[model samples]
Target chain A: MNLFKIVTKNMRQRALATTLTGISVALAVALTVAIVHIKRGMQQRFEQSTLGYEMVIGAKGSPLQLVLNTVFNLDISPGNIPWTLVEKLQADRRVKAAVPFSVGDNYRGFRIIGTTGAFGETFGYKLAEGRWFTCSIEALRDAFKEALEHSQERIAKEKGDAPAKPAAHHHNAAEAVIGATVAQETGLRVGQKFIAAHGVEVSPNAEEHTDNPWTITGILAPTGTAVDRGLYINLDSFYHIEGHEVRDAPKDNDPDPGQVSAIALKLRSPIHAFPIYREINDGEEAMAAFPAVEVRKLFAIVGNIDRILLAQAILIGLVAGVAIAVSIYNSMSERRREIAILRALGARRGTIFAIVVLEAVAICAAGAVAGVAGGHLIVMVANAALRHVSGFTVAPLTMEVAELWVVAGSVALGALAGIGPAWRAYRTEVAENLAPTS
Target chain B: MNDAVLSLREVRKSYREADGNRLDVIQVGQFELAAGDQIALVGSSGSGKSTLLNLIAGILLPDAGVVCVNGTDITQLPEAKRDRFRAGNIGYVFQSFNLLQGFTALENVRLGQMFGNGTGDAVELLKKVDLAHRLHHKPRALSVGEQQRVAIARALVNAPALVLADEPTGSLDAANGTAVLELLRQVCTEGRHTLLMVTHDPAVMRHFERVVRLEELR
Candidate 1:
């Protein structure tokens, strides 16, 4: 028989211990695989969600925070820049298209984006159902008129005056084009009215719209990323939903409508982004953030987290290796007579060593298979839970370099674990051993 | 005998005690074994009979000696070559049966032929030991006499140039002991294999063609 078959047969001889060792290795493999896959999955999602964005121009704060708020839609904006300032930026020769986003409201944890219909086209968003907002002043008036006809008409009256001109849109009211995720989450369809409020922390019992209700006119399709969880509306409508009202007593009573959470600037070319970024940051009041750079920094942060976890996995993997070593050592004691018999029959010490090493590798391979399968199982369960609870799909297993690294490392660990025992077996004295055996 | 199967010269062996002093176990000046020869090594306790058997089988390295088996000086061979030489030419029978406890009698016999030049048909070998009906029995399941027979079959299955028996019947009663010795003598003589049996029993010594009485090397 070849060395492998003999080692395997002997492993099966102690059915319980061999199986237990295999399971131990499998558990370690599974845990390491899961951690590695999760880190890669999170990083990949970050990359996918951040693609296509060149740069973000916002009021000066943390440049990273500006990127997070604008590209990922994960955090609040870093205050707001004036519309005139954005207009000035659009006028710049290098600037391609400048879209202003006003964010304040959330349906639940999802963001409500207020921008032009051009935002959809620029971002390449396709509608799962319904159409993008027509960006017409008449459409906004009709939506406000419909909200006035709803059950909470008392609050609708408090919406104050409507937009005056063909260009002007809202004074204290707006319309909402429901995102696919938000619509699916709340079962809100076209013509259904819901009070849109500012911030992700609003209470469930709070008046959804204290003054005006926003009608759901459109729903966007899943982008396979974060956009699925967002809501969109017109910039003027966003101000209206936030209860911004211009009064006749113009002194300090008039709230400034020019204030926005952040401004997102799209340059004509990638090469123009750094120049514009420098230009924006050169002004003391605002900071120009490179969404790509900030996103990489974010990955770096998470990378450190992954590194710590990987170190812990290595530690546990070593412990499992030691357990295999101890098990093999103990078996040596029980099988010394067997070794003596082998020696008497003319088997070399090196052959015995190879047999022992082969046995260890076999156990490791079994464990690695079990661990990888188990790790994916964990990912599947976690993905299902995220989908059910958060309606946000998480990838359980994705083909990536990190996963390959884990598999290769696990096999190497198995080989390393067998080294010590194999060495001991090679050095054993045949004469002394055979002299004591029957 | 046409040629001696085993030859030894001026072999010296010692063991280190707990107090760091070396105890001389054996100081044999010379020994030789011819084909079909059954030589019994007889000695009281601590007389180095088992030690001498190990020296002849190439299992132990003497402090000073030349051990030639099948015309090759095995004493000068490296660890791996010496082991190969031993496996091809030596078989060992122990006092305690020394069968791998986990394997059935058939598997135990199969193990004997594992590194040998040719396979030993375990069924036929077991039948030779009158254990064909009990081939499936584990060492733990076999009685002392049956276990010894399985071990004997295992030792001779490889058809080695020399068979080393260390108190092969030491753990058996007189009835079982005599039966085991007769089988060893019969197999060695019939197969033309050199046999070296270590024993304290005078009756067991009678089956050997020659007898070597060991004494403490002082």
Candidate 2:
């Protein structure tokens, strides 16, 4: 009896067209929503992961690759820096804390990072199960001296000379702390022991360091960052593994020849960051980069692809709008009799016009609601691939204010698309159209 | 004529042919029907019988005259006002029934009532037309006679001062047509509403006490 009832009846009469057109709108909206949502989610996650890391020092290479390797645990390290530089940074008055990490192995696809006992405390990572593993500067220096002796023996043996017996390095127990996801996926508990496999990624042909097994000492709480996906082990225990000797042996009475993949620095003051970054990058041994700036540059390059995808989604939305207009416009001819009948029942022309427009709006409004839900589902499914690629997954359930604008834009699109057909219904001649057609 | 429920004077309507010739359809100088009167208006096909009815309902405007339902000159009102005026003051029944196919019988009647601000009970009116059992049936599901009966109930829903029916039973069989005609005349008499029905069939004219030819009105 009401105008809404009339519009509903009209939509029901043409249910197939209504449904097909509605799904098209939903498809466009879902794509647009997923793109906007994932882009923002991933950017937030990437940026949030860099919060405490003021600067990262690595081998001279792409600053982006260094950040990706150090901050996110994705991509291979550019190269290595000497452990003396780590000791130097640690001794600096301007440097607050310098946590060095050496990466060259994995256990069941999860990377095993060799770091000091200060790592968890420096990064504010909380333990969920056991205490942190024991490591000290003295144990690390002994491991380095022992590695140097081994390198010398290998060199003497290669030259057909009887090699000197290398001094055995005295180090702490080979203990490890596991990230939340690593422990869950590997089922490695606090007392469990696991062997390291050569290389940072999983491979069947990769050699396993079976002779040097590290016992798990702790499991970290879920941080919703790359920290949740790693297996950290004592750096001194890492040096005891075979084939880990420093390749570039230092001369007698030289500084420690030990090498590490990278060092993450926390500044003593905000003002000290620029001077220290310039000082490190100016040197020939290593390069320093701000993790935050490198991430911005990376996404700036990646933002182009995001823009292109968003444009395609918008184009699809425009096509859907046109399809709605054409579908309803074509229906006006068949509905002239119905419109005339309503007129004969004394419905105003404006009322008839509103009915047609409302029908279009109803179709789109329904599609938009369904599209928002579908968009969230797309994010939930995409989180797996995102995790595998970046070692970080965006939070899937959080809603953005832009989603409200998307729904509103869709409703406005429906209104624009309905105008042409509504005008046709308004102009129908009551007397000429009242008669029945064959 | 002051008590006349329907009146038309010096009314003229014409259409322009594809060749640009003006073809006159209605040229009635005077016509008046009092309240409670039941009159059958007869004309040959294409002789403007429905045209005059449309003019009276304000569904079509005459080229040059006034159509008064009660005392208001509908031709003087703007198109929107005329539309509102028609909703409350007039009722129309078409030959083809003109029922929306998607709506049930009761819904169709309710649609009519919605526009005219009617207060009558649609179910009771359908029951009066012997369609209480078929109230929920859509037009496609109803027999032709039942559809015409629903149309009749819709026309009287607003209790208009003037009711115009153009071939109300033209699509029905002889027996159903007679029953529909009896129901229409009985309802008009009971409600004290004036009825003007247009049809070429003499069988339909026989039911009315006063029959007017289109030529005589002109």
Candidate 3:
């Protein structure tokens, strides 16, 4: 019989120990593999969500909060910056494109953002159906002019210095473009209309823009970003809403209409990013945040969590290796006579050593295979759940180079663990063990 | 002397006792066995019969002298070379029939030829031992006599010049012992292989063509 057959037969002789040891190794590997997959998925999602935007300019606050609010739509914005600042940034030669976003409203749980057509173009969003809102400068100017004329006519008719009623004016219908996830969750098709709430929370007493209902002009395709969970409306319509109008006296640098939550800036050249960031942050009106920098800080915190989990996985693998060593060492005592018999039958010390080592390697190899498969299965299930809940999808079963290294390292650990027992088998004296009593 | 298939000269072996004292196990000045000769070595319980068998099989290196098998001194070779030389030239049958437990009778016989210079059919060897019917049976499934028969088949499968049998019938009953001894003699004579066996029973020693007492050899 071949050495492999003999080794396998010996392992089969102690089936319970072999299987238990393999299971320990498998559990360790599965945990490590799953953790790595999740870490990689999160990193990729963070990177993709902030693609193209170099900096976010918003009211002076936490840069990370500004990024979270504007880029990921994860937190409440720290109030708003003047729209005049956005106009000034748009006029700058260093700024390639300055897309303004007006936030602080929601439809269901999804954020409703007021932006121009340039926002969609700048973010590389494609429409699944219908068309983008007709948000040109001409449209905004004409709508503003019509509102001003109606306000004047109302003031003249009421002679007693009363507040101009916006309800009396017949303005153009405000248009809205919905994201793939927003459309799916709300079941709002093109040509349907929905009113916006004043804030993100769903409450019975929350104020709604009942008179300024918006028509769904388009639905964006899935982009696997925060944009996929937002509702987009024209900036002009956003300011015209009842509660959104600027009531305080306008500052010298503030726009006459109102404020925008944040301005997403694309640089003319990547080299100008730092310079422009410094210039914007140095200004009193706004704070500038590099999305990549803020995201890196965020991931550093996440990376610590990953490190702790990775350490636990490594500890588990080491314990599994020890388990294999202990189990094999325990069996060595019982197999002393068998090893002596092999030595008596012309088998060398090296042969016996190789057989024992091969047994350990086989167990680890089998365990690693099962673990990788089990890990991917977990990722697949988690991906489905995450997609359903948050509209964020991570591709499952992606085998990274680090995982391959882990597999190789696990096999090496198995071999190393077997060395002690193999040495014991190698040092077995044939004459002593072959005694009749033994 | 020229035709001697197995020979030993000034071979001595010792072990350290638990009390830090040296104990001489075996010390033989001279020994020789001619090709195809069948002999029994009679010894007491502590006479180091097993140690002598190990020396002849090159399983243990002598503390001081040469163990020559088929004209080559095995003591001069390295441990690895000695193992290879022993596998090719010498065969051994243990007192308790040291057959591998998990392997079938046929496979056990084949295992003997694994490191040998030439391969032989294990089934044919089993047939030579009259164990053809039990070729697929493991050692646990065989009777003492039947297991000994399989061990004898394994020893002869490599076509060695000399076979060492250490208390070959020590565990068998008288009837089974006589049958197994006769089978070993008949096969060795037919195959022209020399047999050196260790035993304490006079009745079993009578089956050999010649006998040597361990006290005299020492």
Candidate 4:
């Protein structure tokens, strides 16, 4: 009896067109929602991971690579910088903490990073269970000396020279602290032992270090960041692995047989950052990069792709609007008699026009509401793939204010699309159309 | 005349032929229908009997003249006001029973009541037409007799002062047509509403006490 009822009747009368157009709107909205959600989530996770890591110093190469490698446990490390650079940054007055990391191993595809006990304390990371792995400056220095001797003996044997008899070495039990996700995935408890794969990612032919198995001494609490996906081992134990021998040339008297993949720096004050960055970049030893700035730059590049995706979504929406317009306009031919009947029954031309317009609006409004729900469902399903690619998943159920605007925009689009058809209905000749056809 | 429920003065209607000549459809000097009058205006095919009914219902505006219904000149009213006036004062029934196919019988009658702002019970009106059990049936599902009865219920739902029936029984078989015509006339007589029915059927014309030819009105 109401205009709304009339519109529902009209829409029900054209259910196929209604459903098809509605699905098109839902498709556009779903894609847009997924894009916006994943973008926001990745940006937030990247920013959060960079919180304690004000600066990352690595081998002279892409700064984004260094941040991704050091802070996010993503992309492979560019190369190693000499350990003397870590010592220098640690001793600097402007540096509050400088934690070195070495990577070249994985346990079932989760990266195994060798770092000091200071990593957890410096970054405010907490142990969920058990204890930190045994790691100290003295142990690191002694391990470096042993690695230098091992390399020297290899060089002598390769050169067909008489190799000196190696001194007796004390075997230290290698220990590791697993990340939350690492523990959950590998089912590694405090007392469990795990051997490392020789590469960052799992490969069928990847070599496993069965000889250098590490005991899990601790598990980290979930920080909702890249830390959850990393396995931390003692830096001293890292040098004891055969392939991880020091690459520096031995000086014999003061053999600098130590190198690290990356060093994360926490500045005493942000004002001292640029000077320290310049100091590191100026030296041939390493390059210094701000993690936050690098993250922003990375997303800035990604934003263009997001914009293109958003443009496609908008284009779909516009096409849907036009389809609605064309569809309702086409239906006006069949509706002339109905319109004439309504007019003959004392309904005004304006009332007939409103009925046509309201029908379109109702269709879009229904589609938009269904689209929002379908969008959230897309987000939920996409989160698994997102976690695989980025170690982060956007919260699917969280609503954005922009979604309200999306619904409103679709309703407005419906109204605009209805204008031509409504005008056609308004201008229909009542008396002529009402005449019975054979 | 003072108590007339329907009045027409100097009413003229015309259409331009496809070949550019003007064709006059209706030219009536003056006509009046008193309250409760059941008059049949008979005309042959294409004689503009339907056109005259449309003019009275305010569905088609006269090219020249005044159309007064219930003492108010509907021709002088704006299109919107005239529509509202038509809804309140005039009821129209077409030969084909133009009920919206999407709606049930009850909803179709309520649709008329909605535009007229009438508070009459639509169920009561359908019950009067002996369609109480068929209130939920769509036009296509109903027999021709039931469809015309639904149309009659819709026309009188607002209890308007004048009812216009253009070949109201034209599309039905004789048996159903006679039954629908009697039901329509009974309802109109009971409500004391003035009825102006257009028909070419002699059987239908005999049912009316007063039959006016379209030419005689001109």
Leading candidate by DockQ? 2
Off by over 4 Å in 4: A168-173
Interface RMSD of each: 2.4, 0.8, 1.3, 0.9
The residue-by-residue lDDT of candidate 1 on A158-224, one tens digit each, is 5664433333333533566776777887898887777665565456664465666667777888776
Q: What is the Cα-based lDDT of residue A3 in candidate 3?
A: 84
lDDT by candidate, in order shown = 0.73, 0.90, 0.84, 0.90
Q: What would the DockQ be for model 4? A: 0.77
Summarize candidate 2's per-residue lDDT along A85-165 as a digit string, tens digits.
Answer: 998999999998999999889988788999997789888999999989999889999988888888888888888999998
Better of 1 and 2 by TM-score: 2
Q: Per-prediction DockQ, in order?
A: 0.49, 0.81, 0.58, 0.77
Model 3: lDDT equals 0.84
Best by lDDT: 2
TM-score of 2: 0.96
Runs in model 2 lying further than 4 Å from the true structure: B1-3
- Order of models, best TM-score first: 2, 4, 3, 1
Indicate the docking level reached by candidate 4.
medium
TM-score to native of every candidate shown: 0.80, 0.96, 0.86, 0.96
Error of 2 at A416 (Å): 1.4
| Clash count in backbone of candidate 3 | 0
User: How well is each residue in B25-141 modelled by candidate 4, as lDDT tens digits?
Assistant: 999998999999999998899999988988888888999998889999888889999888888889898899999999999999999988999888899999999999999999999
Q: Which is the winner by lDDT between candidate 1 and candidate 4?
A: 4
